[model samples]
Target: MDSDTFVYTTYIRTTPEELWKALTDPGLTRRYWGVAFETDWSPGAPMVWEEGGRRTADPGQVVLAAEPGRLLSYTWHTFTPAWADAVGLGHEVYEGLAAEPRSRVDFAIEPSGDTVRLTVTHGGLAPDGTIKELIGEGWPAIVSSLKSLLETGEELPEPPR
Candidate 1:
């Protein structure tokens, strides 16, 4: 458990190929997380993020690795004013996030007999940064919803604001 990184592991009753589709397919992602990423899923490909009708794109927002059903990693989205406003983040909080160095998230998938082990690692965060705090509460819910969607063909209801 590194202070500057967030790691989450879960086992889902699905094939590696299906799990990979859930992670990369915009439709699947939008179902679990109200976010859609537009990219070719190749290393160095730029990613355009669409969330709540707001689009965020940056040169640094790129895929670092893509191994189909094995591994996928990419730089996190840029914290722009529009994104913050759309998500109801205040000006001060948005400024604080924009000031921090961009972080990267990696999704590793492995076959464990009848289930697939998915490990999500979000790294390069400030030890005590606001992003870390927010993601700490955010990723679990998102991952749980993802698991539900994959296993039961339905996503969990959105959490209250």
Candidate 2:
């Protein structure tokens, strides 16, 4: 990953409007994300989620926000309860990347007239072998599952052990 940016892109066989709803609507996201993404479409609004009793909401503000078909960008930190108080894995990681000291998450959507191209960029990941390995292999599966849900309205099977 020479890019220093972890990104995943997929072209869904659906309109931007449909995918927008799938991304922003908590009810619809649950159909694909398997958990509700609690957020209101307002700049600086907080976004968060809980799955299987685990909270995954990074503490930050919604920096870039556009409607329907453009982009959603936000500041993020890996601050789940599991990471709390864990040295060498908290704000230091975020600070090491840049001065902003927060992870950047981007959801960019491009309209192809017949489909929506979705790109997810998750920056500020720990530059470690295990973490990179997991994310590299896992994101594609998740994106493929997102495609399956958007196209066929079916959730992907549970992740393997």
Candidate 3:
């Protein structure tokens, strides 16, 4: 895998619809992943994330054209005033939501036995060391938390041991 891309797969003892809602619903995502997704979930809709003092997906952000379920694509980051005024080509330490450019999130759900396997692929990130490393480390914890939430109906106090 390229340093810019990180792939994570998790098996949850749940149905596809359950997994889909868990992945798509912003409320559910916030509980498990600690990020809030804001979008109408329609094709050509802007999916934005508001965290800290910065808000992603402003001017020049990609708009989702169609969002049925399981797949979400949005212009992740555009040249914000802060980013544009920054000295370097990039300002954010990481990419995706901020920092470097290029961002998209693809989530797929498949059936396995009585459980659903969720595969999350985040790509289009700037090919940088920090972005790659952070995604690699962050994905596992998020995936594990999702798995625990689905199985036990509660967030795990700690990442899977």
Candidate 4:
């Protein structure tokens, strides 16, 4: 693992516009990501994350950049008490992980012939980086689900916890 960066890239057989909508539209995201982002999607916009009856708008999380059908970036979610409880993390472990520098994820979209190339780069992970492992396992599943949804009108099974 690169101590400060983690990256995942995938190609989807879809138009860049469709992929961008899948990533930014809350209704579409809910089908694949289980969490939907609420934001105007302009650079520096605040983002609200919602899932499992909880809504989190941690000060640390916000839209870093947004370019329709091309790129989007945002700070990682904060481990708020409600989020910790939803994810079954106790206060101590959550605090320890949350106290570290918040990470940021960049989504890059590129059109290649008939498909879009999507690259996810997560940066600023903690030295020990407990979140890296979780993200490592989670990103593939999430992206795969997104691809399936776009191509087959079906989502992949829920990512394993």
Winning model by lDDT: 1
What lDDT does candidate 2 reach at residue 125? 62
lDDT of 1 by residue, 25-69 (tens): 999999999999999999999999999888899999999999989
Query: Please, what is the whole-model Cα lDDT of each candidate in the order they appear?
Result: 0.95, 0.67, 0.66, 0.89
In what order do the candidates fall by lDDT, top score first? 1, 4, 2, 3
> What would the TM-scores of all predictions be?
0.97, 0.73, 0.72, 0.94
* Candidate 4 or 1, higher TM-score: 1
Score residue 55 of candidate 4 by CA lDDT. Answer: 89
Over all chains combined, what TM-score does candidate 4 have?
0.94
Model 4, residue 116: C-alpha shift (Å): 0.7
Clashing pairs in 2: none
Off by over 4 Å in 2: 55-63, 82-101, 129-131
Q: Write the per-residue lDDT of candidate 4 for residues 1-161, one digit (tens) a residue.
A: 55788889988999989999999999999999999998899888889999986888877789999999999999998778778887888888788777778899999999988889999999999756778877888899899999999999999988556
Backbone collisions counted per model: 0, 0, 7, 0
The list of candidate 3 runs beyond 4 A from truth reads 1-3, 52-57, 60-70, 75-99, 158-161
TM-score of 1: 0.97
What value of lDDT does candidate 1 attain over all alpha carbons?
0.95
Error of 2 at 91 (Å): 17
If ranked by TM-score, best first, what sequence of candidates would result?
1, 4, 2, 3
Model 1 clashing residue pairs (backbone): none
